[model samples]
Target: MIEVSKDGGLLTLTLNRPEKANALTAAMLADLEAALAGPPPAALILTGVGKVFSAGADLEEMQAGLGRNPAWERVSAAIAAMPCPTIAALNGTLAGGAMGLALACDMRLAVTGAKFFYPVMRLGFLPQPSDPARLAALIGPARAKMILLAGARIEAEEAQAWGLIERICAPEALMTNAQALMVDALAAKAGHIAAIKALIG
Candidate 1:
């Protein structure tokens, strides 16, 4: 499930199926895609409700053919296309296809103790098309290979050092830290934000 909240210029999208580690179902992916379908918000934060941000696609759903779903790419593409700043406020471990979402974000912040990995090699699936390039852009090509090929599970500290995540915060302070990063964007005009993002890109 996904929970959406709009606070003035900031829009927060939270993955809410904590009991299942927020494993994404087809419907959940559909909801996510729909949520980003309208005009882009001034700023957006993608986060999760429980200890784990997401365990990637739901196992049962994957077996039913969700693993190769185009929705994953669509959702990630939507996030990457947003003219406003987008943040992935990772609450815990990030694994599998979920890495695509975080990599698509303009920036990523994780809670201490969080782990990052993409086991597409071991799982016998290629990652969503754009994930590897986005990840490589953030952390470099070799390290991205370490994750996608060697299946290395990167700890939060290592992730920051390797440039995978921008910052690490205490679990309780994760959302606060994320909001802090959005303040400037939220205060700026949407067109101004877009112009700056374009310049940076």
Candidate 2:
């Protein structure tokens, strides 16, 4: 599920299913696409309502839907194509397809307790190859290779040092800092931001 809140030009989207570690479902993906397509928020922040940012696709549900589902991919692409600057406030662990969701954002800020990993390969599945390019662009090829190939979960501190995360904060302050960053982002000229994003992408 997703919850959206707007304040002073900042729009926050929270993944709100902690019982399942915020695992994404097809309906959630549909909601995300609808939200993204409906309006252009001044700045967007993605976060989790509970301990984990997202554990990834709901494995059990994914298994049932399998090849029949293309919604997740569509939603991911929509998030990546949003015109406004987008940020991911990783409150805790992020893994699997959820990792891809975070990568789609323009900036990422994680809590000190947060961790990141991509384990699609371990599940006997190939990851979206485009994610590697995006990760490399944000961090570097070496770090990206290490993460994807080894499937090692990197902590917030190391991720920040490696340029994977913009900053790391205490859990209590994660949303505060994320909103402050979004404020800064909203202050920038929208055209300029869009142009830069376009050039980079």
Candidate 3:
């Protein structure tokens, strides 16, 4: 479940599984890989269609299949490999593997009530490989340690202050403003954006 839309240079991928809190599934991961496996768009925006960004991996499916882990890892890698700037529009909560997806993006915008959560400590599961290092680089060792070690779920305001998100928008203006920001950020500088993104990554 992914809804793809393109307007000018921005390609938006919306996770469309509200029924399951937009949980990340193997098929969804496949779709995401396919979407990113192309010449880069000027900007890519990832968001959820419903109220929650993602509840995490499809636990029920994982119960039936142990193969979901590698696919999920690839999803995060695909997001990171995009040559152009990428943004995560956090309409609601992001849990578990969803954190890696958002962290892989170049920028992140979250609505006021949105949150960031990971259960690595509580669930005793190893996080995606790149996640701990990237998160620590963004927020610092102590704060990142607090989050991953204690399973903290920080809300939007605190998340922004701690470098988890770039900005917090009111619910109604989230997507519109996110798109506008992407357009403004990448206008007439697609090559430069790609160059800098490559350098950074």
Across residues 1-201, which tens digit of lDDT does each residue of candidate 2 receive? Answer: 799787866778889999999998887887787878766777988999888999888888868864246775676677788888888999899987777778888889888788888886578766665578878988898888788888878988888998889888889999888787766568887787788888977
Q: Where does candidate 1 stray beyond 4 Å?
A: none
Each model's number of backbone clashes? 0, 0, 0
Which candidate achieves the best TM-score against the true structure? 1
- Model 2 CA lDDT for position 199: 92
What value does the lDDT take at residue 45 in candidate 3? Answer: 95
**Where is model 3 poorest over a 10-residue stretch in terms of lDDT?**
62-71
TM-score of 3: 0.92
| Candidate 3 lDDT over residue span 8-127, tens digit each | 788899999999999887888888888887767888999997789999888877576533368666777888887777889998998887788899988899888887888878876778
lDDT of 1 by residue, 1-201 (tens): 899999998999999999999999999999999999998899999999999999998999899999889999999999999999999999999999998999999999999899998889998988889999999998999999999999999999999999999999999999999999999999899999999989999
TM-score of every candidate relative to the true structure: 0.98, 0.90, 0.92
Ranking by TM-score: 1, 3, 2
lDDT of candidate model 1 versus the reference: 0.94
- List the lowest-lDDT window of 10 residues for candidate 1: 117-126
Regions more than 4 Å wrong, model 3: 65-68, 199-201
